[model samples]
Target: MTDEIKVPDAGTADKAKLTVAILVVIAGVAGYYVLAGRPAWLRWTPVAGSLALAALVLAFSRYGREFRQFVELARVELRKIVWPNRQETGMTTLVVFIFVVVAGIFFWLLDLGLAWATKLITGQGS
Candidate 1:
């Protein structure tokens, strides 16, 4: 088997639906800016309406249904996780902080040694 990610192609109708959904959102944004002098609710009408319309249009698309299924599956998987307790979390955080400080010190010493070597070889530190 090849190590390639394979994505299924949505058919022509689904592609058209997705395109219309995108255009609806773009038009809504443009309308919002174009109606900037209007009242807040009036300006927001197109934004809200377009989002709802876009979502409605997207519901008919194949990938949209797949996304819904993915979200549902994710929720099921999310519930199976055993999260770390507060004490375990604190210990892990402390270990990470200690390693970071040690790494920083090691890098700083390496840099200083390299700088000293370069200056000595070139006699440019004066």
Candidate 2:
């Protein structure tokens, strides 16, 4: 048995769809600004409409399919994760905070020691 790879041909239609999708998103932003004088409800209509249309267009493209698959896989992986409990999370955060404080103190002391040494070497310290 031979291992064969099948790549989907991105034809003109897919490219057109992707272009239309991008244009729809741009139009949505422009439309939102254009409808600024209108009421809030009316102003948001074109933006929402354009976004939906763009999403629809993209859904038909190869990239969109791959994105959806990735999302699905991510969701599955996330579900499989053994999440830490609230107590464990709190403890981890506390540990990080303590380490940060200790490191800050160490760095501050090192800086002070260096400053003192520099002044002594330059004969500038009283």
Candidate 3:
């Protein structure tokens, strides 16, 4: 009866894509070390290329498609949000700062009172 949004299980193809993506990223790092004697750009090229290839492979998977949809939806939702203006934000921040200062003073007084009471009970401080 719950109105839960269920994510569908990834199919074999999707799983393969995920696996390939991970392998590609790993291969990129391996290549970086393998071409240690090569120029910096040459060593980095395989790493960057592998990452790009992995992203392409992942984008075609079911999860990847879902992720794309999610991102689009997020953008739509972001546009709907009414963000607070600078004046409002400044006022809210000022209020929070005042409350924090008050709380700190209150706690300091409470600590002092407790310490005095403890000393009086123990007859340790004159």
Model 3 ranges with Cα > 4 A deviation: 1-9, 29-52
lDDT by residue for model 1 over 15-60, one digit each (tens)?
A: 9999999999999999999998999999999999999999999987
Candidate closest to the true structure, highest TM-score: 3
Model 1 residue runs over 4 Å out of place are 1-20, 36-45
lDDT of 1 at 20: 97
Global Cα RMSD, each model: 3.9, 3.7, 3.4
Question: Considering only N, C-alpha and C atoms within 3 Å, which residue pairs clash in candidate 1?
Answer: none
Candidate 3 matches the true fold with a TM-score of 0.73
- Badly placed stretches (over 4 Å) of model 2 are 1-6, 26-49
**lDDT (0-100) at residue 10 of candidate 3?**
91
In order of listing, the candidates' clash counts read 0, 0, 0
Q: What does the lDDT read for residue 83 in candidate 2?
A: 94
Model 3 weakest 10-residue run by lDDT: 1-10
- What is the number of residue pairs that collide in model 2? 0
Whose TM-score is higher: candidate 1's or candidate 2's? Answer: 2
Global lDDT of each model? 0.95, 0.93, 0.96
RMSD of 1: 3.9
